[model samples]
Target: MSDSDLIKLYSKQILALATEIPHLGTLEDAEGEAKARSPLCGSTVTVGLALADGKVSRFAQNVKACALGQASAAVLGKVVIGLDRTTLQQGRDALHAMLTKNGPVPSAPFDGYEVLLPARDFKNRHASILLPFDATLNAIDAS
Candidate 1:
């Protein structure tokens, strides 16, 4: 495969998501907050959330990473609202499998993770791709 093919991993769709981050701010009154960094690439993601009725009521993030990390943040932002810990954990597990174990895409709500399939072949990108979900879980645990 050519270098162009490797570069193509960041498709237009993924770039769109990356550049147009959805929940792209901080929640001052967040109940929990956590940040994750990829030591290999120096990519970072900080997530904050407030829970209501045991589900996500508000969510926000600051992402400093590549297009793949930004896209993952966008996908997480889109579906995080109203989600519970169980649902989030399932998504995280599925995402891990998809990237490392050749498993299917994450289930609904997180099914959008399919947009990241091309990234699976690039192991170096895996930690950045997983940052949003990991930060979210860390925040949840901290709360």
Candidate 2:
């Protein structure tokens, strides 16, 4: 990619989000845990969580990835509290579509994901960007 393309993909907002990723550690009593990796970029994310009332009661993650992935994780961490699997799944799917199919931004709560729109053209970054969501979904199932 060109320097301008890289600049567009890794905007100040995305880089700032990367530095502010929340829930940075694992839960000691986590009921579920899962990890996802992007073979192309070697980016990885591990998620640990607990569910209560069919909603995410606790969430944490270890993200070792590109700025895009870290930004994605930060967005998820910002709104993961109190959300159910269905909503999380919808957000994940919507995010995937937005990146791959030019679909609309994910609805409320997940609207923070709109910052990632510039990444749509970088198909190689898509998997790493989705790692946090994939790991979280798997962790939920493991719970």
Candidate 3:
């Protein structure tokens, strides 16, 4: 697709993803939790995680952000629900690679993350897209 077409398509996908935001659980009985805020944009995310046998048993989030941040949280909510710690870390690494290193397009299961590919072109939005995952990783590390 042309650059403009790609941008339009990603914008539509981002908006569609945003609609899933309301489905994200805002609370969890987690072993640990972490909150992150972007003072530049006032976007904030709180990640709550439960651990069982050294694995992630539950994960949820509370987020107050713009469309980009909300959509990223929604995407995270879906894929992160059942992941183990290693996989979760891998996902975070994959996302970082996609966002910062022009890595390969995320494969199936995580193909939904492809919708965020456009975010790379817009640097200011990077933090918004990464915020939820960052908080989740922080929480997981602390757990």
TM-score to true structure, per model: 0.95, 0.98, 0.83
lDDT of model number 2: 0.96
Better of 1 and 2 by TM-score: 2
What is candidate 2's lDDT per residue for 1-143, written digit by digit as tens?
99999999999999999999999988899999999999999999999999999899999999999999999999999999899999999999999999999999999989999999999999999999999999999999999
Query: For residues 56-138, what per-residue lDDT tens digits would candidate 3 score against the true structure?
Result: 66777888888889888888787776566777677777877898999865665466788888777666777877888788888
Deviation (Å) of 96 in candidate 3? 1.6
For each candidate in the order shown, give its overall lDDT on alpha carbons: 0.92, 0.96, 0.78
RMSD per prediction, one decimal?
Answer: 1.2, 0.6, 3.2
Ranking by lDDT: 2, 1, 3
Model 1 C-alpha lDDT per residue in residues 1-143, reported as the tens digit of each score: 67786668978999999988888878899999999999989999998999999898989999999999999999999889999998999998999999999999998999999999988888999999999989999999888
Question: What lDDT score is found at residue 8 in candidate 1?
Answer: 82
Model 1 TM: 0.95
| Weakest lDDT window of 10 consecutive positions for candidate 1 | 1-10
Model 2 stretches astray by more than 4 angstroms: none
Worst 10 residues of 2 by lDDT: 80-89
Which pairs in model 2 have colliding backbones?
none
- Residue 111, candidate 3: C-alpha displacement in angstroms: 2.2
